[model samples]
Target: MNIGFIGLGIMGSGMANNLLKSGFNMYVFNRTREKAKELEDNGAKFCSTPKELAEKSDLIFMMLTDVRACRAVSEDKDGFLESLSKGKVVVNFSTVHPNYSLELREMVKEKEAMFLESPVLGSKIPAQKGELVILSAGDKEAFEICTDAFEKISKKAMYLGDVPKASYVKVVNNEAFATSLTAYLEGLAFAKKIGLDPEMVFNILNSGALSNPYFEFKVKKVLNDDFETHFSFENMKKDLGYALSVADEFKCYCPTLAAVNEIFKKGLNKHAKEDMSAVYKIFDE
Candidate 1:
């Protein structure tokens, strides 16, 4: 497939590189043209605009930061929709509001193109390894046609029915992740306050039933205070906001998530560009 990928940030760059390595004919674009240089060196074609990329590609994938970027890329003067035609598929891997995904679906449909909400789970490391799990929804035919490309970029890709379902699930997953990480950081802070060694506490936790790969992987970063941006605090905060929106839409009471959301909001002042694990610094403060 001739694949067009937009937004070559930390995650998108890794995924796009893997596709290029897999020998796909890749056409790429990024707001900052410099980000696409490495991929271009690796034989991927660099397009100056989304419309140009869409015009030459069969499947266009967007791994943008948020809904606004997605909108601008699709509706701008030289947007993808300008050149999108029938039989083309546009897959969005950005974590966006499910409602917005539905709206984009309609817009793409109007262009006689297919839109898939296929937000992925995993950050820079997994994306680089092509091990991220994909949560996808839209037309099954579009999903099927992209299966080979998906395999090149993900460990697994699930088709979850229709537009917005996959987006909804991605927000819920991030909600659980943010809340759980916050709870873990709070407990570590409590341990330190009580004169217990936080590292020792983590060792105990890692030995127990509560242990999982995320905690194991993150504990080292937390202890060493390595707050690199594998996934940014701002993005996690955005996902939490999306989660709260979903909660409000369904009339669901998510008290813990609401509290966690506020904690992330507080971190926005200082740690927004850092890793999500930097939420620990809020407690450290």
Candidate 2:
């Protein structure tokens, strides 16, 4: 299949490379052309515009930043929708508000094309390793058609049956993660304040019933003070904001999520571009 990928950001670049390595014909585009260089060098066609990319590919995947960027690329003069034809699928890997996913579904439907909200769970490392878990919704037939491509880039691909479901699940997952990470960091800071070694505290936690791979991975970054951007604080903050919006739509009460969102918002003052682990610095402050 001829696959078109837009937004060659941290996660997108890795996922697109896996598809190319899987032997699919790949076309890529990015606002910053330089981001597409590596993929181009790997034999993927680099299209200058979304419209151009869409015209040359059978299925399109977008891993854009937010809802606004997603809309701009799909609706602008040289956008993908301009060249998107019937029977084609457009999968979005970006984390966006579930409501917007519904809108995107309708937008693509209007063009007689199928759409899937397929936000993923994993960061730069897992994406590069082709181990990200894809939670997808919308158009079962389209999901089946893209199974091979999904398998190439992800360890698992789940079809949750319709727009907004997968988006809701992804938003909720990120919300829980933000809250958990904040709690973990706060405990670590408290441990340090009480004259305990932070690394020793992490070691204790890692040996207990609460031990898990995610925390194990993040704790190492925390101990090393590595805030490099596997996933940016700004993006996590954005996802928290999306979670709040989703909760409001469903009339759900989420006081903890609200507080966690504020914590990420505060982190934005200095660590917006750094890894989400940089939130630990807030506790130190």
Candidate 3:
């Protein structure tokens, strides 16, 4: 497959590396052109514009930050829409609004192209290991054709039926993740202030039914005070906002997520560029 990828941030960079290692010829672009330099050095062709990349590839993957970026990439003068061709597939791995995905789907279809919503369920480490979980939706044929690529990028790629369904699933999944992580971190924060060893708190709960591997991995980072950026607080806040939008559209009660969103906002206020784990600082802040 002649493949292209735009956006080379934390998650995107590793995903691009996996695609390159999969032996596909890659066309690449990023607003911060320097971000693509590493991949360009690795034999990926670098393009100046999304349209240029779109024109030259049969498949393009977008791992952008928000709905605005996603829309701009598609509709801007030198964007994806300008060069979209029939039968070409564009797979978006960005966590954005489902309604925006639906609108983009229609725009892509108008050009006889297919748009696949493929929001991922892991951050930098998982992307580096090609172990992210992919929730995909859109044209079944496009999904099938991209299965091999998805295999190279994720541990599992599940096809959910249509454009917005995958987006909806992604937001729901992320909202739950934020809520769960917030509650866990709150416990750790409480343990610290109350003179209990936070590590013991993590160790005890982590040994029980509610345990998850990520809980252990993240606790190590927290204990070490290593708040490097795998997934930034900025991006987490963006996804949290998108998830809340989904909740509102469905008229679903989401007090937990609503409160969680504010917590992430506060985290971003001070440590905007740091990893989401920096939200732990919320206790001290």
What tens-digit string does per-residue lDDT give for candidate 2 at 144-246? 9999999999999999997889998998899988898889988998899899999999999889976979988888988998878999999999999999988
By lDDT, rank the candidates, best first: 1, 2, 3
Question: On residues 1-285, what C-alpha lDDT tens digit does candidate 3 reach at each position?
Answer: 899998998889999999999899999999999999899999999999999999999998999999888878889889988999999999999988888888889998999998899999999999999999999999999999899999998999999997789988888887887788778888899998999998888888889986998877877898889989888888888989998878888899999999999998877768889888788889744
lDDT of 3: 0.89
Residues 1-285 of candidate 1: C-alpha lDDT, one tens digit per residue: 799999999999999999999999999999999999999998999999999999999999999999999999999999999999999999999999999999999999998988899999999999999999999999899999999999999999999998889988898899998898889988998899899999999999988986989877886799998988999999999999999999999999999999999999988979999999999988888
TM-score for candidate 1, please give it. Answer: 0.99
Q: Could you estimate the TM-score for every candidate? A: 0.99, 0.98, 0.97
For all candidates in order, the CA lDDT equals: 0.93, 0.92, 0.89
Q: State the weakest 10-residue window (summed lDDT) of model 1.
A: 210-219
Q: Model 3 residue 197 lDDT? A: 92
Query: What are the RMSD figures for all models against the true structure?
Result: 0.7, 0.8, 1.1
Show where candidate 2 strays beyond 4 Å: none
Off by over 4 Å in 3: none
| CA error at residue 175 for candidate 2, angstroms | 0.8
